[model samples]
Target: MLSYAGIQNPYALGKYSVEKNAKVMQRYRFIHESLLRIAAGHLPAREDWDIKVALGKHLYEDAEAADRLRARITELRTSSAVLNQEPDAALSLLMDELIHARNDLELMVGIYGVIKPALLDAYRSHTATTQQIVDQPTIRMLRSMILDLEDQLSWGEQMIVSLQQSGIYGDNGDQFKAGIASLLAAAGGIDGQQPKTAVLPHRIRSHEPYRIPLKSVRDPRKMGPVTWARTSVLNPPEDPVQRSLLAKMRVRQEEMTAAELIAAVLFSQKNMPWEFYRDLARHLWDEVRHALFGQAALESEGIDWMSRPQYTSDYDVNAPKIPGAQYAWLAIGIEEGAMKRPGKAGEFEFCRDEAKHPLMTQFQDYDWADEVVHANLGRKWSPDLIGEDISFVREIAKNELDHFWTEVRRAQAQWNEGAS
Candidate 1:
């Protein structure tokens, strides 16, 4: 049977011209940039653990969305110059206020309550109005983004409710969101298609631009300055097999120290290609996942993971001492070692073959896969940030890692002596 061409369909293309579609994407791209920046900038200072993880994931998700839009926009036009420019100043102002969120409460309300929901709406509107057949590629890209945005919105909404129950999100939540709404109103909404209001709200962040904090803060549960790997004093397991399992889990949970450093690098390093930020965002999120694996493993054994000492020292040493570009190269260098024989691969084998532990095996399997990707990303992009000499980058990275572990050993020694 022959399928009828355009059965029960209107012959007319939908509303947008190529130029108009590109403009809409530009607006979305800028908003995604704002989302990425806010998530990365506030990560170091955001104290809530769950929220911190959400930010790690969201930053990467936002970067992916923006990168997709950038790709689509390039297809729509000749020069990629338009992707680099801000689509609207009022829009930029709105973003500035959003990122300047004074506390976690304000951050949640601004991003979840106001901006992201608006962004979701704008995306839905564009998808609905654009010519479906002519702009099929864009429509496909946006469909995927919309699914992610919806999931993110649901997560954010639940987080807001949790905050409200804890009494952190109060009446001021409405007020803060209103301020953001007014800024968006002045900017003519996320798509820049609405009527622009000339008068703008008094800028809350007028005092100074938001500065990315050099250090990340954690909840009260985080006890640190003690290195996890070198000493078994804090997380001592009696049985040999159990001790080995817990030891590896500790490594995974402490992966956050690495994630925190990556977040700092993303925020501090500027003017790199968009690909750098995008790749680092994924790297940061992967480290967070590794940390969660460790957390979960410990908890499964009826252990209080957070109650034990966390390793805050890795981030402490490198974040202050090194430039972001150098820090990035250092991370890539570490991952290269991690992918080798005695690292992730060996860990996976221990879990699967020797330990006879299915869950830890699963964890190690994915952990190995993630590091492979991270190592590949490092090899591809590290040279661009540092120099083309791979061996030199590796040497510098090794020395830095060695120095960081040396300082960690010294701290552990003093701690052990004090305890004794």
Candidate 2:
């Protein structure tokens, strides 16, 4: 036989059959969905600002991985209809335990220390066994997923360490993680191919169903009133220099509400297209990044943002309402309004010209750019999700915004009266 350039041996083929590969892909899909669920579920409940931000970013990555896995799975023997089907009952139960983990430390130990590393191993095993030339597409997909998973695991490890150092981990934290690991072992590990040596562990989900938070949680050390941005003492300083400082502080602290609202929508809405979730997840992460930008800006000025109030009203009011209404209000009204004059661009120019702060100018510059994308994201997804014309959604969102500001004003008045 003539030699082929790509083959080690002309007669040899890869180890896994088509059916086997598809099953592996299904397992990957399930892991990714669980990742999405874990991150979205915790975004509102997790109090640490950095942890919340990290969850926002991870959820977006989870959504992306899930989307890609679906495409690859569809190309296999299975139909698209089976894409959402549960791969294994035990695996499903395992996820329930992770989602219902007692606290942030336990959740960290389960997800990062156990599930994620196992997932990475499964991906590596598949790639190593599969034929590279014949299964190039799957190989490529797994490669991308591996990169993202590695990055997430890196951060997850550091975060776990930070949690441990802070003395937050309960004495039972390791035992809790071990119980979860034993459950995974009973479930046949991440790939569902390992021996079921251990029996199912006790489940937190059994005691109580996991409820997504109705409002965003803030760290007690950093907690503040929802009126922080509205109060002149905290924001909108008369001095230009202080104005820029406060603006960054406002963004760093206040955008948590945006993240909380977006996560609420992702968790609550089930009927929207997968693309809607992906885009909105990205939108959620962008808001978190913007908040981080504000954090960085404040750090540059030796200001402790935790010393100031982080606003919660934006999440508090909308979270309990219909998610559709919240989405419409934010995407259509506030974000679109931000695209106009004296909004993001105006803020940028103020930092550049009046404040003459180079760091603030750069921060606002990107802030303006991000808002432009968010405005378009609102236009693209909000109308379809809300089942209304864009104009009508805009009008409705405007009314909602008006009502919100009215409440803000009323609260401000009460604060003033109390002081007098």
Candidate 3:
């Protein structure tokens, strides 16, 4: 078992007072909520593959850390509910502004550069001030979470550098940095502000849900329908050109769905357990990686994936505003369908042997593995949201897919009519 030396008597000398423990837990809760909000808000605005994957990973880690903090509070013989105590008015205002960032650059600079650094400083200060032996559990949790925060800090800095090099900020790069600094200062600088008793309105609401604005989505044809018929395990394609086309389509579908999944989970964060959101975020990131693999395979064959038309609308755009469970069930069904007989594995084999495409086969192999994991994740979490009834889940999934295809077909007809 793991051990911490020089900690024989936990509460013997320099024991942490109840008030101090309460304060620390309260601050942790504030940071926890802030991280979730940041993750949710930034996700939809960002379309770059690398940045999307990073944000998903960061959100998962932050959510897990928040849970650990809650657990620590419970260990101190205090109710975890107390951690939801009112946040500082200034900090709350700062978070509100951060969430409303106009673009990815602003969101990245505000959250990673400003808010995250302040949270990191707070964690460090807590670790330093609290008696290590008496508060060893909290200390250990803070230390583990600190590593993730540091990684985020490094990534955020690199992102800023990349933005500067790209000249996207024009001659205003320094101006943006200064603006972020000012915002940080307003929220009481890197150490964080003292908590105020004034409660803010509920930020994560089901009614006023956060949806990805259709206009903000990168592809102009994201809502456009596929012209080709849907491929199935029972009726596989034979022609090499058709197979390549199918592979490219699969990549595009995964990319679009992954983006939708990221937004859906963020919107549904309040309705589900933190652990559920955490797991789903990791799955979302994996789907992103799968999309990247698909893109790479197409690029290897000298195919411009972007030039191709997308076949489906985002799930978030079509699904009802309430109960994110609908999206989850829909995703599970889609993943299961992909992994059925003559599915991704069969596709991989065909690419390798018949199509004689080595790189395509490699991409399919990994994509197959990722899909299996995703299906298992769906199996694990779907029951929690809907129930143990597998048939019900499958039914929901099938209906959603059908509706999606219908919408796609309609959109495609309109596009064709417009072209003619």
Q: lDDT for each of the candidates?
A: 0.78, 0.79, 0.62
Clashing pairs in 2: none
Model 2 weakest 10-residue run by lDDT? 226-235
Q: After best superposition, candidate 2 residue 156: deviation in angstroms?
A: 1.3
lDDT of 3 by residue, 1-420 (tens): 155565543444443576667655666666666767566566655645456667767777777787777777777768756766654555565555556655556667777766788778877877777776777778788898899999989998888677667656554345444565555565455444443333443432223434445422443332233333322112236875666656554554446455455556555546565567666666766766666676666566555555444433554435453334555544575777888788777777877777766776777778788788888877777766765566677777777777767766776577657555
Q: Which is better, 1 or 3, measured by TM-score?
A: 1
All candidates: TM-score:
0.91, 0.90, 0.73
- Better candidate number, 2 or 3, judged by TM-score: 2
Instruction: Note the residue pairs that clash in candidate 3.
Output: none
lDDT by residue (1-420, candidate 2, tens digit) is: 245645434344787777878887788788777778778878888877778888888888888898998898888877987776889878888888788776778878888899999989988877777876678788788888899989999999998898888885656379878878888898898877887755555665646767887767788755554452343234455876777557655565478788888888887777777788888888999888877877777777776667555677677777767877888878878899988898888889888987788987887898789889889988897788778988988988998899778776777678778666
Residue 243's C-alpha lDDT in candidate 1? 81
Estimate, for each residue in 87-117, the C-alpha lDDT of model 1 and write its tens digit. 8889888988888887777899899998889
- Deviation in angstroms for 353 in model 1? 2.8
